[model samples]
Target: MHAHFYAIVNQHAGNYRGYKIWQQIQEYMIQKDVRLSVLLSAYPGAPEDLAYDLASSLPDKESDVVVLAFGGDGTLHEVLNGLIEAKRHFPLPLAYIPAGSGNDFARGAGLKSASHWKQGLLDLLQTTHAQVINIGSYQLQENQPRRFFMNSFGIGFDGSVLKRANQSSYKNLLNHVGLGAISYLIAAVFTIFQTKGFPAKIHGLDLTKSYAKAYLMIVTNHPYFGGGIKVAPDAKLHESNLKFVLFQRHHLGQIIFDMLAIIFGGFQYHMKAVDNTLLTHDFTIEVNSGQTAQVDGKSIDQENYRVHFSKSSYPFWLPETINKKR
Candidate 1:
């Protein structure tokens, strides 16, 4: 029962260290006598196209192929979308190696540290232990193409933070020093004073509500976001439900306090600022015109979106030892 490993490497991710890590992984595979191949992503969204082509070429029945994503959460997001687009009902088994600045998905999934990820990946490739996790989907309109996310989706405050951080020189500097999470915190502080609340309406699975001035709306599939912040402490990846956390228009001090709470694992104590926290299988958010949004830390230029949470069509391989610990 040999496995065919294909890694989709993101060359631009994580302080320009992807190529070096890929080389190490290739050498390790050679030493272990395992089959290995790689597809380098040349540009944004290239992983999706490559994943689609690879998945489409597979035989109808299950095979020994395993797709490994060697980038940040965004790379995994693109690859997942590509495989789902190729075959909605039965995508290939997937694995991941954290190699990006904000690896919230890896943290939430309890993956090994970056220094030890090669051994963790090798362990998965050598066995068939896999888990079925849920994926979140959203569309701006009923007729629009659906976008998938393996982590959290954010609007207003979170979107602004990501936009600012991506455009700032600090993020790159932080990445180089292996302190990428601090970049997001700095961006959030800068954006907090400048951001304004926007009107929003949320229609959840069991409740519907409206807000005249909403500062933040985060929908999460797991407990971590913004590089290991436990924003949704109770979220489970295997559950077919989405957890929503909303922060209405609040004072700068309150916002800062909440941010600190999230950073220091004290979010439960600051739940007063949270306008609503609910679990729903499906929901829709209508934001004021000109507002922004983000899906899995990537900014989106949209004011409205309908989100649906459901189990993934395929399973993903995880290191058995790590899975047991979780």
Candidate 2:
């Protein structure tokens, strides 16, 4: 276990739930006499800046240092990007605490904490070894720098939902009422009528084909997305393979069934799989038409681009009590 901690916290996330959780954690750390350095992010990209400068200034031989991120998947996403952008030769051990409404990454990564964080938090802080697991990486264009995502990638319908949800006034209202995750569902309902879907060309994966109207293209490294929904039931984080789940729309009736099933409950159980889903080592997706995109629940502004997906391993400072066997 690492003695020193570099914690990047977002106090305003999840309607100040991040701040509330931090209070509990801070008291625990003090009681245990653990050395903690707290950095609070005030705005959107603050965590990335804080993490980038921190990693850039750190020594290469510090085996006892762990950078702890205390926020949502998006915060973790920024922190990991910052560390990678620093161009360090050695990987910095990471520890994460889920403070967002839809902590799908935490669930997908087999983390012991989510709803029951009190005991789970203590277990992780006292964990013996850092758990090594596979993470995702992608590139938007040929010359563009590679970026990382923790959970899954989405394009078209789901991306539009996330993009809208992030900016919607009702989202804040829902958060105030402790229904923050339902924001995605509400946004998706709006997008369903506004969006007509888009076409895409698939390549690199063994079974490549053209998609007429890809209502949803979610390439997952694990089983969870949009809170606890198992969009890709067979996808596992420990494994190196990425599962591609695509939903094609033939008509309004077909897509209403496909998209609604995905939001309310698990999609895999409702639909029969034939050519819609594929699994491989890696794949390249090209969308010629304009559409929205999202990585790990955060919106990407780019439209009409090529993206490639692959996997790499990172050591997350987590408890061994996590289903290590999985």
Candidate 3:
């Protein structure tokens, strides 16, 4: 039986879904046998800091302690990165309850139970074992510390659309109404046609290409992105290989078809405009200057940056679900 639980919560996630759920369940959790400590995040990066401190505070072999995260994928992303930064000799187990709009992490990680997080937490409370999932990491510059992601990373159109959706005031309204995904749809519709496209050079996984007008390039460790879209069907949680999928707008008609194929499914694999490559070893992706980038749904500013990609590991103490464990 676990003796203690450390909960890192991002209340603002899913437009207060995380906080609202936690508030309703905290009393019940406190009454349970396990000791519980809670930390609320005030802003971005707070969860990461809280996760680091919690991991550092635990003993190396503290098997009875588990860190529980309650938020969307972005919150989970920070918590995992924080644990990685702590650099503990042994991995610390984590449990998650996804309460965000685009729960791509939950979708990919086989935690659909998160939709009803109260039950999800209840199920997790009974689990005694944790499964270790291999995650993804990247570096914008050589010799720099690695940044990790559990879902996927994208540059060019994929990222630009997310940036616009996340920054738009309509996102707040949509999130408030539990229709946040609509923002992504609206943004995508406008971004695709407006994009002039950018250049890129990709090298790794026995597949190399240089594109003069790469509309979108994404590296995914799992199959789901953009709230449930199968962005890279070959990518899976248990698999060690990453899928680097790229798209080029050689012609307006062809580019529209590519985007439609991606959104509606089927024919993407056969399209000449789409390049889906399996990345087995370390890879380098150089994008055109002043491009927007995204990792696990967070925006980034990368200009002519050559990002390095690799692998990492995180131990997840998740409740068993119908989906295969990763």
The segments of candidate 1 whose C-alpha lies over 4 angstroms from its true place after superposition are: 303-313, 324-326
lDDT of 2 by residue, 1-326 (tens): 54588889988768785678688888878788888899999998999999899888988664777888887778888988887788777767788888776778888766754346677677777876676787888999889888887788888877888888889897777766557788887777777777675788778846577877777788777887776767777677777667778777677766667655665666545565214454556778888777788888898767486898777777788766777544
For each candidate in turn, the TM-score is: 0.92, 0.91, 0.94
Residue pairs in collision within model 3: none
Rank list by TM-score: 3, 1, 2
Residue 176 error, candidate 2, Å: 3.0
Query: Which candidate achieves the best lDDT against the true structure?
Result: 3
lDDT of 3 by residue, 1-326 (tens): 76377899898986775577678667778777558889999987999999999888888775777888888788989999898889988868888888787888887777743346666777888788777776889998887889999988998887888889888988888877677767887888888777766889998767588998888889998877776767776677877778888888786777777777877884587887788888778889997678888999998986677999987777888766625534
- Per-candidate Cα lDDT values, in order, are 0.77, 0.76, 0.81
Q: Measure candidate 1: CA RMSD.
A: 2.1
Runs of candidate 2 with Cα error greater than 4 angstroms are 112-115, 205-207, 263-279
lDDT of 1 by residue, 117-230 (tens): 677666776666567777678776777677788898888888888888888898888888778778888888898788777777887567788887778888888888777778
- Name the TM-score of candidate 3: 0.94
